[model samples]
Target: MRSRAIFLAGALVMVALLGGVTANSVAAATKTTVTWKLSSMTAGQNEWLSDLASTNSPGVKTWSKTGSCRFLPEGFKGFLSMGTGKSCTLTLKIAKSGKYPAKTATHTIIRAPSPATTTTVTWKISSLTAGQVKNLSDLAKTNSPGMKTWSKTGSCVLSPKSDPPKLTMGSTGSCTLTLEIAKTSKYSAKTSSKTMILALYGVGDTGPAGGTIFWVDMTRPEGSQYFEAACAGWSDRTCGFDLNEGSRDRLATWGCAGTPITGADGTAIGTGEQNTIDILNGCEDSALAKFADRLVLGGQSDWFVPSKDELSQVWVRREAISGMPGSDENYLSSSELSANLHIGMNVNCYSGCYIHIQKENNGYFRPIRSF
Candidate 1:
């Protein structure tokens, strides 16, 4: 009986120890019961706690605070981090009324270097020049390791023809360029647009007739003022001279019976098309004028023989034109000097070709048109 009582007393002591441990276990719970952590964030980044997922641990009391940082949108759980240049600590204290002991979760926001940005996105030059190359890299100053893109939305042909373009302006108008830079680890993302005005066309540019642009009259009346000397093989019979005049077997003449034409004496830049029309109406068989009238090129059919002064302009800029027909110096002008002596001009080549088109080239013709 004495031995059994001793064993019974030891068992009672063990039970008391076990009961105390169970009580302590209920008072001190772990994160396994209620899950949460400090929101993920970057130190130098300007961001809101709204960018993060919220924690609504069921039936658990939550309290949060920060050191040398900010919580935004709301003070209890929302935070905006203007915390730059150093590590920011967000302390979250979570507890339950009768379950877990009060504990704090310290989250250190990670720090990284700031991004590089373009100082200015404006073009260095006042405007774009036709037939000249503009360096796009000069438009901005940045240490970003990524590329800068330049683009425009229109039918104008870029010189290299890429999405973001480098262009030789096709005509005279407005040219707007857009700069786009994608986000990168070392650089911030950015997009900016600027419009530039280019109101003049230079000689020696590609014209509407798929021919060389030799003259641009921005000062003339709007529409159809630029002149393109047609490309080689101007997509027509040379000079329209083979077909006899009207019904008679008469080759092209300044007028019927080589008679002096009455109103075919225009000699200016804007008068070539009209001169060709006048000659055609007067003689009804003028080939030079017919060639200019009937030719179709670059999807345009407005070709014409240049007048005397117009032909001079062509002579001065002949080198800028392509597919110049025959080396002869008897090229006819729509302007006539008299009955049998029609005004004419051609390239005079001595040391090389130079503009002395006070001369002529007859059979193979030089033609021009407006667009």
Candidate 2:
């Protein structure tokens, strides 16, 4: 009986010691649970937290938890890390500052005042010049009365075009740009606007025709209003010659039958009348020699008629064509005019060479070029 009692007491002591150890282990785990979340984030915001049940684990600057991520304010340069199965509330208060090197200043080139539903966007300088690039942030401030200035938080870029920069966008969308001057002081503080939509995109791979892109040097005017002539004045007769009083076809008494007329007309005529009677005898008369002369658009003097292949490119982008103003017709496609021509010229796309007609007796001339 004495031996049995001693054995029972030994067993009871062992059981008590084991129970105490288990309780202490559970208490240690409970003490490690994290409850705080992150807040007040500016540039490089950082925080550190202990892992559940880790007695002496230090905090990290940035770490991932399953599918979530953590960021630090710019000034706070430390981190808080957690391990698998660990849970922590991350409350963040982000500050608006333009300190991030990755972020960019933005300025937008919009077509109109309330560009809410505008798709065909055109942009021009009201206080600037064509081909001038400005930072998107600057542009936005210039254009809008109330909007937050862009922070150095995202990519912003500028793209200028010699012509009015055009873009297609959702009715309500925004774009960013970086702008610079390319013309004289006379061009400064000048205003320009787009007839279509526009937005700035960061540097990337793209097609030549993907965007309204141009390069400008503020020293002198690189683009001009030369391209924009009164639609009536753009006619062959108005551009290159005056008609003799009698016959339209018979070249006037000028000594050179085919020389383009440089002298101004003595009489004044309405723009509408000029377009109706313009004889295709000047630059348009010769498809090969003078087809590209006397271009007037976007203030450019070097404008020319697009070559056949170039015109074909325009044909493909017909969606972009804002046809001659005050006319019901679009520019003639090779297919559209072939059937209507009183005099048909050669049009062979395969051989890569063909003839085009510009006769005074038949059709009118509509000059065009790419932007």
Best by TM-score: 1
> 235-343 in candidate 2: lDDT tens per residue?
3333222232311111111112234322211121111112212222332333322333444434433333333343333333322332222222222212111211211
Candidate 1 whole-model C-alpha lDDT, 0 to 1:
0.58
Off by over 4 Å in 2: 1-19, 26-34, 38-236, 239-303, 306-327, 332-371
| Residue-wise C-alpha lDDT for candidate 1, range 25-124, written one tens digit per residue | 8545333242334344455455644343233333353445455456655545545564654666655555543333455555666555554554434445
Query: Over 4 Å off in model 1, which ranges?
Result: 1-197, 235-257, 325-328, 349-361
Report the Cα RMSD per candidate: 20.0, 21.5
Structural similarity to truth (TM-score) of each candidate: 0.41, 0.25
